[model samples]
Target: MMALFRNLFAAALFVGILAAFEPLNYKDCKSTFKINSVKADGCPQENGKCVFKQSTFKINSVRADGCPQENGKCVFKRGTNPTIKISFIPDRDLPKLKASVRSKISGGSTFTTFSLNNDNACEHGIECPLKAGQTYEYTQSVEIVNTYPVVDDVQVNWVLSDEDDSNKKEICIVFLAKITE
Candidate 1:
């Protein structure tokens, strides 16, 4: 009997240790953004100006490190991998998602664009057939593939829509970003 109790205790301790190292749930996490090894508040700005934006979805937490945030926004570099994390609630079923990004130089006429489609939310690691009124954190990595002489601003947009009707967007999120180099 004593050996049985000891074995159970060991197993319980092992489980506890594993759970302690698990990544925090989206709601409970309070992570910060890092740019070039520096902590940032949001995306970067240009000429002391940053056009910050968000969406109707409830964002519990956000972090965009590769794209450092400054002056209440974030900044990205050309030919770099910029990552973004957002925890939000759809508030309705969303079978698919449409995401697009475009950038216009701060003082130039150059532009850069990238578009993606998530036919099945789960295929992209997002819960598909998303339950209405449930919150989920989405982390996406965007590669800046433009070689424009200048990339001043970026507009990140996402549309959550039903599978049957692409024209009907249940939710929309548009965020602006500043770029350098």
Candidate 2:
């Protein structure tokens, strides 16, 4: 009888330790915005000052970093429900394109397999948003993939027409990356 109780206590203790070490869910995101502008003959001058034209872009689809730590492994949730979103609004008037974005992407850093679509507003397609305005969103489908967590970063580029010249602007959308089981 005493041995049976001891075995049960030991098993409980082992389970408790395992539970304490379980992976946790952690999320973080950062957004950087930039604008590119060009004028026809030259920037529009107001009061003899130059006013540059602009086209701005929005970044979206933020993911989390998959690193092992105290809070993360502890609070890690089971499924992917709430994904991070990124947004942008041009300070001026012009056309904007979302070229490309990478998340926890590796040498196979290709997101072509993901469900990416065009935003109603512009021509660029890489990191295009679901809406035409500035706000855009991409969701991380956490499921069997969480078996091995990872940290990810989302980078994007947009093209701006400066007069007859075409220029590109860059932006970064960072997230809390996690790859775990």
Encode model 1's per-residue lDDT on 50-148: one tens digit a residue: 222334444454444465544433566777766554555665666655444455545547645664433343554457666656766555566665664
TM-score of each: 0.56, 0.29
List, residue by residue over 95-140, the lDDT tens digit for candidate 2: 3443332333334454422223443224332243223344432222
User: What are the lDDT figures for the candidates, one per model?
Assistant: 0.47, 0.29
Q: Which candidate gets the maximum lDDT versus the true structure?
A: 1
